[model samples]
Target: MDGRQDEVAGAMARLAEGDRDGAASVLRAALARAPDDPEILHGMACVARASGRADLAIGLAGRAIAILPAAHFHITLGCALHEQGHLEPARAALHVATLREPRDVRGHAALAAVLGAMGRGAEAEASLRAALALRPADAALLHGLAARLSGRGAHGEAEDLYRRVRDLCPEEGAAWANHGAVLFALNRHEEALAVLERADGLVPDVAETLNNLGLVRMALGHLPQAGVALARAARLAPEDARIAVNRATILAELGEDGVAERLLRGVLADPVAAGGAEGARAAFNLGTVLLARGDLAAGWRFFEARTRLLPEGRWPDIAPWDGVAPPRGRLLLHAEQGVGDALQFLRYLPYCLERARVVLELPPELQRLVGTTPDPDGLIASRCTVLRPGGSVPGDVVARCALLSLPHLLGMAEPPPFAPYLLPALSAGAGGGERRVGVCWAGNPAYRFDRRRSIPPEELAPLGEVAGVRFVSLQHGVAAGDPPFAMEAAASGDWLETARAIAGLDLVVTVDTAIAHLAGAMGRPVWLLNRFGGDWRWSAAFDRAERPCWGDAASRWYPSLDLFRQAGPDMPACAWRGPVAAVCAALSRWRDGRLAGD
Candidate 1:
């Protein structure tokens, strides 16, 4: 072998033994004999960078690149620059490395990383895809692309790629874990649990997989299994804000919000939980916890974090109005959630008076019913936008904020105007001596907690048998079977028709759906059936210790409403019957009171 080759081989052997000083000595000796040899210069540059002499490394790598203009020499320079946190220069060097090699995996990977560091995510994705194209069967490159896609919210395509990656690398625990996470996002909890379990067998100590397993179990209402998994994950990754938040969520759902409040507060104080997306999420979660416990100003302040949690499409760049009546600009209130949420929060829109020329936006489902909203202060003359998915927002609007954020802006400690806000034009009164009670046994199926919040229509069959009470269906969907009520065949689609029907009913019995919100706003008396893991609004209102452990029977938002919650697991599988019976018992007493008065 040549003298220079002998010295380079000796340097590599020293570096392999973790002897940086010995490696540098041998590399310098080689460079002295062949002053501009690219091989010796490349070896010297890598050794210098490893020893924390980035300036020396960069100079030697530059000399090597000038001698040969080769891929490895350029890569060595890029690594040296990256070690010094010189991202832009590193990016340039890596780009050249990729160009020189054309198909080398290391150059492409390094280029992609530098591009990502420089906030060029799309270009990084392209670079990674290029690497994958060269090594189509490579599991790591495919997995990397899948992770990037998932981060960008392209879950459907990510899921497909994750499946491919899992098949290609069955022993890779992270691949299985990520595949399970995609399944969780797609609401395929059963598949997620199965895959996560498989991952656990391969790599039992992985915190992320445990976190996902807990989440899947929680979604299925298996709280004990979820708690065990989540607690374990929290212990494993005590510094991961995501794991801590998930643990807190389990506590919150199971009516242990006090512990959740503590856990979330502790996590928020830690550096890991104090910034970035995790910080935003923790802030939003803390808002919910504090709000549930009746801390208004603090909760509302933290609730501002919701803006950060949402996608850029959902939360636009227009200056958000800070609950102040703007002196000179038109204020836009954009709907950021479902039609039901639009209905619930519409009360706040009219309050945004001559403060600004208002352009309110809401979902199409709620457009027809907007006419019925109370404008006692007299402002909503301008037509609001009926937003559809992928539709462009108007360019004329000045400041924009989400409709759900109204309560935080309004500082609403005082009770809402209890008088009817929705006095739709009266339809003909029903001809019956019996008290007509409207019933809604379901909510939109797409809602994440629909499994816990909505009851099957058939579960209300027992209530249908009540004497002197006629049950009328206010449900909207393809029923599992013929409804056990007297809903008019003509009364199924339009929100206005539904409003008119609800206005005519003597009372309404429903789950925590938008219909309940509508009926409550219209001054109709309602019995709101709540799940054990009820919503934050209901928890805030009825989570008093003075109430029965079973549940509270009153509402704060809907003054004319009564709440009935599902019994806890200790109460028998027949706990479902408790809410049904509560409504029936209340109905019977109302009938008796009417008869006695007559």
Candidate 2:
């Protein structure tokens, strides 16, 4: 090679070896000797990009591409443009690179990232596949592909890719974190925790790994441990809005609303972090906490931030239609979150129907249940639409909204006062002179915060001791066990059957689970048992006191239920005892009143 070409190659070698400063110095000296050389200009651009000077990088790359329109020059220019948020230009540059050198994995990968950022999942996936085809064993490419797959809800494929990445790059903290995230998505909490812990150990100072560790711990119901991990992560990466948001979520789970609110507000105040989806998340969560505390006006305002909070690709971009008049076209109400969330938020269908023709896209499991909802027009079931596939809906719908956001739109100032609104399939037989009470002691094990929210059957023994109240098991799955109460497992059928059984009972009592939501929806008197830090749905506006007695708590979208919270982390058992006894006393009083009338 010529002397100049040899000098360029040496500089590139230094860049590859992590000597970014040395690479920049050498490239600068070479650029002085050959100022307009494409290779030298591209090399200098790369070093500038690595140093976080996107403007300088873009200038250097543009000059290089002008000097010689080569694939590497285009690729370097694209990288700089992508960093500057010029996605379209970046994509165009990457396309040019790929056309010039179709086998270039970096060019394909850059295109994939830009496409993914633009919310074009299918195109991104295709680009990612093309990149992987070129460099099949590249760990970074595999990680990117796995993330895109996970985003598309292709957990099986994503998990396999994550496993391969973990196996191949055992020392890569990011690969371990990604693997743990997939495991967590699949509801493998124990395994997820172990993987996340390993990742944390591998990179002890990494804030993201520590934040993930906190998330897994929260899922496993280890509130204190999760709090500790989150706190450490927040301290280490104070500027990382995601870590702050995560820490706030854990605090909310622990029922420390004051502290959680403060941290979340801090995140919101930082414009740099707040401008992105993470900022929107801080806003959305802040609204949830505010609403839980019964601050109606502020809660709704923050809740509206969901439109901006969601990361691209999770949901479609649909304009928010004001409920003033019927929409000019059909509106799609897509389900977000879980079955219980769909059921709880279905109350908003009436409000939406009042405003426009509505097409309700719900989980198939809840199709029959949602069908029972009394909607005069425009409620359609989403059948065979690939939530697991990167499928897109027909673009004809005028507007779209997430199902969970319905409650906020309906202006749920307090729990809705409607009871027995959701009727179950079971029949209510005459109580044999005893107050029949239904109970669910657990929640979905897959919930990230289930450990802190769900109570074990054994932990419910104290409630079983309530006199004159016949407790029935409303819980399902392996989590249910006969615990010395008048209990029957929900019959096999649909949720309608479960709803019917709950309907027949005089009252339903449950921990933070779907059954509690079912009972409340059915308008059956429900006394909901809550963890001290309870979900954002239960706390009051002032004093952080637990809200029990339907009307006593703030009015909301679902209002037939009362909340009783365990006092603190160390005294969860003791905290619940008083509330259980109070419920027993209330039932006794009702019984006595009936007898007196007779």
Candidate 3:
């Protein structure tokens, strides 16, 4: 190569190595010798872009393109325009560059970035795939495509591409963090934690990196570590609503409710955060905190913001049922969250029945069981019709309401009706043996809070020591592993079948799952294995000192239920021995009482 070209090459190399000063010095010397040279001008533009001087880079790139209209010059110009937030102009420039040199990867890659920023996701993905076809093994190309896929919620493909990127560029902290985030989305918390820990070590001060690490730690139930990482992230990006929301959630979980509430309130009050997705999350989290502290009125109001968190088109075009008046025709009450949620909120059907004809939509799992629920006045069997989710709505249906929205819509200042609302299957007969106790050690693993809410099966071993009690296993889907105690497997074909088994037991002990809700609805004696800062329904247990109770402690929501909470927020799931020991002692006391009665 000639002398001018050699100087430009050296400058480009320095710029690629992040030595912007060295690149600038080399480009300046080259410009002095050949002031009109396009390559030297382009090299200077790169240095200016790397230094974050997008305006200067735009000027230098324009000069290079004016001297000799080249594809590379247009690519530089497009990149500078994109950096300056002129997305349409940047897209036009990149389009011209790609048209000029259809084989150039940089032109296509830059066009993809501009398209992505413009929210033209499909076009951007197409451009990225075209660029990848030319440079199949490029780490940057793979990472970009992976991020696009991740944004589109194609986590399986994103995970595979991120794996390739990590293998190709193991030292890149961003690649590791991206990979970890994909794993976290896929619910592979252990792998995500390992990957995020590596990323935190490599980029300890990066707010986004620490945020991802904190989320992974939180999912693994490492509360203290999560708090530390998220605290640092919040400090680094104080104005970032997403980071603030996450940090506040961790604080709430850790019993630092005052600080958590303050952070969440600030986010809700900020104009930028108040209208965005993060703001909605902040509002929902604030509601949780308030409800946990027994501020029912404000909690329900703020909790209304959760509807904003739902994806667009989540509901049909039908008008929503306003809590104010009885629908002229049928009121559709649809379940929104988990089965446990549906079971808990089904109590509100009678309230809806009081106003209008009620159409209750539920998951198929609970259809048979819910069909068996009876009302002393025969309202349920006569007026309320059970429909499967997405089932055909009757032509007379006028408005719909989410099952969980009942309390909020009704403006309930206190806990709604709490009574035995379900009937045990007739087949369920009384047990005559040792006091039968049904036990469930875990909940649905797919749930976001399952790690914290679920107990390790081995912890149930202590219950074996409680004499005069027969333990019946109520766990479903997955094995709870062998405990020191003999647990008879209950015949649970469905929710109704489980209810049958539960009806026969003298008492039920379980995590926060559908079984707990079922047993409570049956007015069966139930002990809840509640996690610290668990679901809002269990708020009475969390703030029992301030919360009013109709029956025993923590049974305001379910008069027949009791609660066994984690000793503290920072206690890991494996350290569940404390609650298990408590249950063991309680069981022994109950046994002694029964013996004394006999």
Candidate 4:
């Protein structure tokens, strides 16, 4: 080879060995001698990119492209532009690279990523498909496709693709991680854990896989293990905000609010976590902890970040409508998150109805469950006019907001008053009871904070001791394991059956899970069992400390209900026992008329 070619090859070798500084020095020396060498310029760009000097890389790549107009140089420039967040320019450069070299899978894949970030899923999917066609056995291409499908809520198809990728490349850590994520989304916690564990073992230092493992462990009620995994992930990727946020979430569950707050603050201080989805998560988590600590204003500000935290294309593209609607027009309100979230935020429907003609889009499951929510003018329906996977309002609607944002829009300082809201049919043999008391010892196990919030059935045995109270299990679909406390188990066919049983009861006591939110929304007298770091909604303090522990005992915002909190995380069982005893004693006194009724 000629001397110049020999010099370029040496620089390329240094870059390949991850010695960016060495590569840069060699490239600079070659460029000084042969300042217009296309190969040397490209080599300099690669070194600059490896060293995190994206702008320098862009300039160098531009020079190389000007000299030889090579597709590879355009790909290098695209990558550098992407790093600088010049997405449109990066996309244009990637398009030129693909045009110059149609068979270049890497160029196509880079373009797919840029298109996906721009919310052009259809185009991105097409690009990914083209890349896959060129390199059918490529594990990275399969994983990327699976991720895109998963982001669009095509879980079944995504799961199939993930499994296929894993089968083909059993040792690929990213494939296993993707598989775990899909399983977790499907609520297969055990399978998720196994998959994540496999990924963790294969690539022990990958921060993303470790984070996924931590999430699964948390879901399975393994708090300490989850904490360890999350901590390790944070340590491995100190600059990654998601790892820090995940770690903080686990800490909050462990009731270490002080530590969680500090970690979240530290993450927010990093510029990378300041404006996008990561920033939103950091803000939301930080707000949640603050709200639990009773810092309302700051908590609400952070809470607002929830909208920004959604995946790039998941949120509605339409602008939020001003409260003042066009004459004779309607405002669309859509649900986000879980059923409990929909119910909790439904309290704002009445206020919204007062301002505009309201149409609410809800989960199909809750369609009949929340029939005519807020009554009269507000129309509640299962389907939207323009149904999109991630919630979206109608194009014709002047404005829209997520149901959870109603409280903020309504200018409410505190949660609206509670009343006996949803009234599903009572089950056979549910009524005619002498002060029925409903109970739910556990919650959805998939929740990351389930370990802190849910109690095992065995811990609820104390409630069976309460005199004049007919304690009945209101948990439905899921099994209620044997409780140490003596209580009668009531069989339920569905949520309606559970609701019917709860209707018969004078009160219901549950953990800070969906049931607690359901009971509260139903305007039932519900004694909510809360952990030290409870969810944002339950942080609101209420009155009426004594009541039937069931269906509408006190009228003052379920004035009939009460709140029982664990004193600390070390021994939550001990703290919970005292509240159970107190509740039992109160029920006995109320049954005896020792406490006068209003």
Number of the top lDDT candidate: 3
Q: Which residue pairs clash in candidate 3?
A: none
| lDDT per residue (tens digit) for residues 1-598 in model 3 | 3988888888888888889999899889889888898888888898898998999999999999998999999999999999999999999999999999989999999999999999999999999999999999999999999999998999999999999999898898888989999999998998999998898788788899899888888877888889999999989998999999999999888888899999999998999889999999999999888988888888888887888898425457668877866637788788888778888888878876777788888878788888777788888877888876567888888888898788788877577757777787645455876799998878888876588888776667778777778888888866555444688888858788888888899889888888899998999888888887677778653334433221124567776787877767655645577777777777777766632123
Q: Lowest lDDT 10-mer window, candidate 2?
A: 380-389
For residue 484, give model 2's deviation from the true position in Å: 10
* Model 4 regions more than 4 Å off: 1-210, 256-259, 265-272, 310-318, 324-328, 364-396, 417-430, 445-452, 458-471, 480-501, 540-558, 570-598
lDDT score for residue 56 of model 2: 95
lDDT of 4 by residue, 1-598 (tens): 3988988888889789888788788878888988999989999888889888999999999999998999999999999999999999999999999999999998999999888888899999989999999998887888889889999888888898899899998988887888998988876778999999999888887888888888888776676788999999988998888888889998987878789999889878878777667777888899889866667666766786787766324335555755554475567787878777877677777677767766577776666566524454324332223243355454556666778777656666565666656776666677674877778877776564565567766566666777777777766445466544657777545445556666667778777666766676666678777665456555543334445443222323445456776544444446466556655666676666575342
- Tell me the RMSD of model 3 versus the true structure: 4.6
Order of all candidates by lDDT, from best down to worst?
3, 1, 2, 4
Candidate 1 lDDT over residue span 1-598, tens digit each: 3877888988988887889999989887777777879989889888887788998999999998888999988887987888788999999999899988978887887788788878899999999989888888788888878888999989998898899999998998888999999999887877998999999889997899999999988776677678889999988998888898899988887778888888878877877667778778878888887777778678777877887888547544787878787666567787786666777777666655545566666666666777787666556655344445456766766787777777778776534555677777756665357678888887776665565666756677778777887667788876524676555432655787888888778888888888888887887888788777667777655343333312255566667776787766322235468878876776677767742123
Each model's TM-score?
0.78, 0.64, 0.83, 0.60
Off by over 4 Å in 1: 1-36, 44-57, 267-280, 294-305, 308-336, 348-359, 374-411, 426-450, 455-494, 501-509, 540-552, 569-598
Tens digit of per-residue lDDT, candidate 2, span 1-598:
2887888888889989989988888888887888888889888888888889989989999998898999988998998899999999999999999999999988999999999888889999999999999888888888889988898899889999999999999998888988988888887888999999998888786787888888888777677888999999999998888999999998987778889899999988898888888889999999989887778778877987876755335444776555444436667777767677777777666666665666567666665665555433433232212132234555655777777666566665654445444654556453566677778877776565676677656566666666767777777766775453546555555677677777668877777788877777777777777776666666655222444343234224355676665656644445456556555555566545542123
